[model samples]
Target: MNKCVGTTEAASLLGISSRRLRQLLEKGRVRGAYKTGKFWIIPLFNHLPQITKGTRGPKGKWRTSRPPALAKINVNRNHIGSNIKKSPKDRKPVISVKRKGTNLYGNEVEILGPCKIVYQPDNPLDCGARLWIDLRSRYANETFSDIHFIGGSFPATR
Candidate 1:
């Protein structure tokens, strides 16, 4: 029979923590290691098992696969509001609006743009749609009773 040592002695010899040795023993990563009574018996001559390093978390299709393409939005002229018309001639040069907020992924996101949607990703993981509106716009500063959309009107915020 091979000479065996306790987990503490084996951990010290292997230059690792006793708790880490216990984990390795439990996972069957430690060679010539076995449980006896309430303690672990590791062979004295055994070395630390080779551990392959790769991506830390679980492997899934999201790691190797590309995100889906963004859906194209076709704007109908009849559905557009008179005030909110999409005319290149009526478009004005506005200052960039910057806002800092947290995304659904709990990441700190800083958005900078004019009075329109700044970024619309090709494929969104959390929310499919992201509308960025500048609060410094002329209409934003004015006190409006209701805000008009393409389909309906919404209550304005104070």
Candidate 2:
């Protein structure tokens, strides 16, 4: 459906930052609307530039160019190795995310990660999560990719 999406919503939908989205609008690559004192809105057009979901936005202009092949890297999400039982005073599950990796541009990416939702009491399953490392390379041949959460019973909560 063609909906008039707000700047922030459009950015989230395209998986690009709001700043990047504004730049694209400024370049006239993707059409958008802005008032004197209001938020910019991107019209849902039929022929908008297709940015792959979760792929980082191009740095400068939106040109017709392909990206390079990114090397296949394996992401491992391990548990604490040792399960620690919470004392009677402390009552909370122990499952935290540990994310660390590099982007296509070799930028250091690290995050504390999100906490898992407890469906049942004290379910100590380490629900693995995958985060897409964004590359800051403006080159036309930089490998743009997304993180795929695999190997876990529960789906990774974004």
If scored against the real structure, what TM-score would every candidate get?
A: 0.29, 0.28
- lDDT (10s digit) by residue, model 2, range 1-158: 55576767666656568888876666555644543456665665442334323336445443224333342322332222222454433432222223243322111222232222223335322433333222332322122344332332132322
List candidate 1 segments past 4 Å from native. 46-158
Model 1 error, position 145 (Å)? 86
**Tens digits of lDDT, candidate 1, 1-158:** 55677888666655567887787678776666778899987774323233223345553111122122111121222223442665754432221211122112111223232224334466432434333332223332211122222323222211
lDDT of 2 at 69: 30
**N/CA/C clash count, model 2:** 0
- Against the reference, the lDDT scores of all candidates come to 0.40, 0.40
How well does candidate 2 match the true structure in TM-score terms?
Answer: 0.28
Worst 10 residues of 1 by lDDT: 98-107
**Best TM-score among the predictions, by candidate number:** 1
